[model samples]
Structure formats: structure tokens, C-alpha cells
Target: MKRVTGIGGIFFKSADPKALGAWYRDHLGLDVTDWGGAIFEWGGADSAKGMTIWSPFKQDTTYMAPSTSSFMLNFRVADLDGLLATLRAEGCNVVGEPQTSEQGKFGWVLDPEGNKVELWEPPAGE
Candidate 1:
């Protein structure tokens, strides 16, 4: 079974999310939105249509709990449930149950280094 296909997003903590976002917007021209992030559309002859998100959370955010790392990597997966099951069978530290929203289906797991990893199955046709 195919595991991770590509990176879905990159998230990190910041002392001042707004300031950091503005810096990216002004200096890096990231088109940071009011939500303090930007979506990068990508399509190549050898790749599937997709987008990558770049965001920064407040330093105190508890989203990456169980991980002391300051960053989280979101991976794009073709089959979230299947891949998660395989990870569990392989003794990976699968986190909470998977969740689905308009955006897509999401699952969490911890890598060997204890970094929180997010697995995402983008909404159909996305």
C-alpha cells in the first residue's frame, strides 16, 4: 500500500503568530491570510493536483501535545484509514481517532522521534 504521497502542510509554533505571518507576507510574499497562513497550489506533469498549507500557531497552542517539538508535518495520504491501520499494525504511535470535515479527513500519529504528524486525505476532486 502506498504510504505518504506528499507533504500536505507545514505548521510551527511562534511567539507572535501575527507578527511572524506578517513578516512572511511582507518579506517572503507568501500571501498570508487573516488566519495567519497561506495555501500554495501545486501541479506538475509528474504530480497530482494539490495544495500545501503553511501556517504558524501560537506558542502556547496545545495542538502538538505529546510532542515537545515546535513543528508538525502534515502528510498527504491516499487512504487515511488504511494507512493508519497499517501503521498501528506496525507498532506506530497512532494518536486519536480520525476526523472528517469539509476540508478533508485527518488522522494523527507520532513518529519515532515523537514528532506529531498529521495525515490528511483531501476532499474528493481536490
Candidate 2:
């Protein structure tokens, strides 16, 4: 079972999300949108087109909860259910159940260092 195929997104907490986003837009030319983030699209030599999201959340947000880490990593997976079961069998700290949305199917797990990791299986043809 192939686990993580690629990074789906990178999310981190910021003291001032607006200001920080603006800085990234102005200085780094990240094309930060009004929602305070950017989507990067890529196509590998032998891979299908894919996207990776970059976003920052307010410092007080509880999205990365159950872990005190300032950031969470979202990984793209081929099979969310199968990989999650494999992680559980391997004694990994898998968290929560899988969820489906227009964007994709999502799940969460905590690493040994207590960092919350998000797993995503994007909708077909995405």
C-alpha cells in the first residue's frame, strides 16, 4: 500500500494572519488570495497534475489542536482508508475518522513528536 504520495498542503499558525499573508504576497510574490493563502499546481514528468495548498491560520485557531505544534502537514494519499488501517496496524496514532467534502476525503493522525498530520485523498480527476 503506497502511503504518502506527496504533500497536499502546509498550514501554520500566525500571530497576525492578514499582515503575514500580505508580507508573503508583497515580498515573496506568493499570489496570496483574499482568503490568505495560495494554491500551487504542479505536474511531474511522470505524474498527473496536482495541487498543494499554502495557508496560515489565526494564532488562536484550534485547528491544530490535540497538539501544541504551530504547524500541521497535509499529505496526499492514494487510499485514505487503506493507509489509515495500515497505520493503525503499525501502531501509529491515527486520529479521527475520514471525512468527505467537495474538495476531497480527509483524515488526521498524530506523529510520534505530537504533530498533527492531515491525510487527503483528492476527488477523482482533481
Local distance difference test scores for all models: 0.77, 0.77
Q: Write the per-residue lDDT of candidate 2 for residues 1-126, one digit (tens) a residue.
A: 998766666666667788766644542346788788888768888879877777789999998888899888776778888878877886777887889999899988886567787889999886
Give the C-alpha miss distance for residue 5 in model 1, angstroms.
Answer: 21
Which regions of candidate 1 fall more than 4 Å away from where they truly are? 1-42
- Model 1, position 57, has a per-residue lDDT of 99
Superposed on all Cα atoms, the candidates' RMSDs to the truth, in angstroms, are 13.1, 12.9
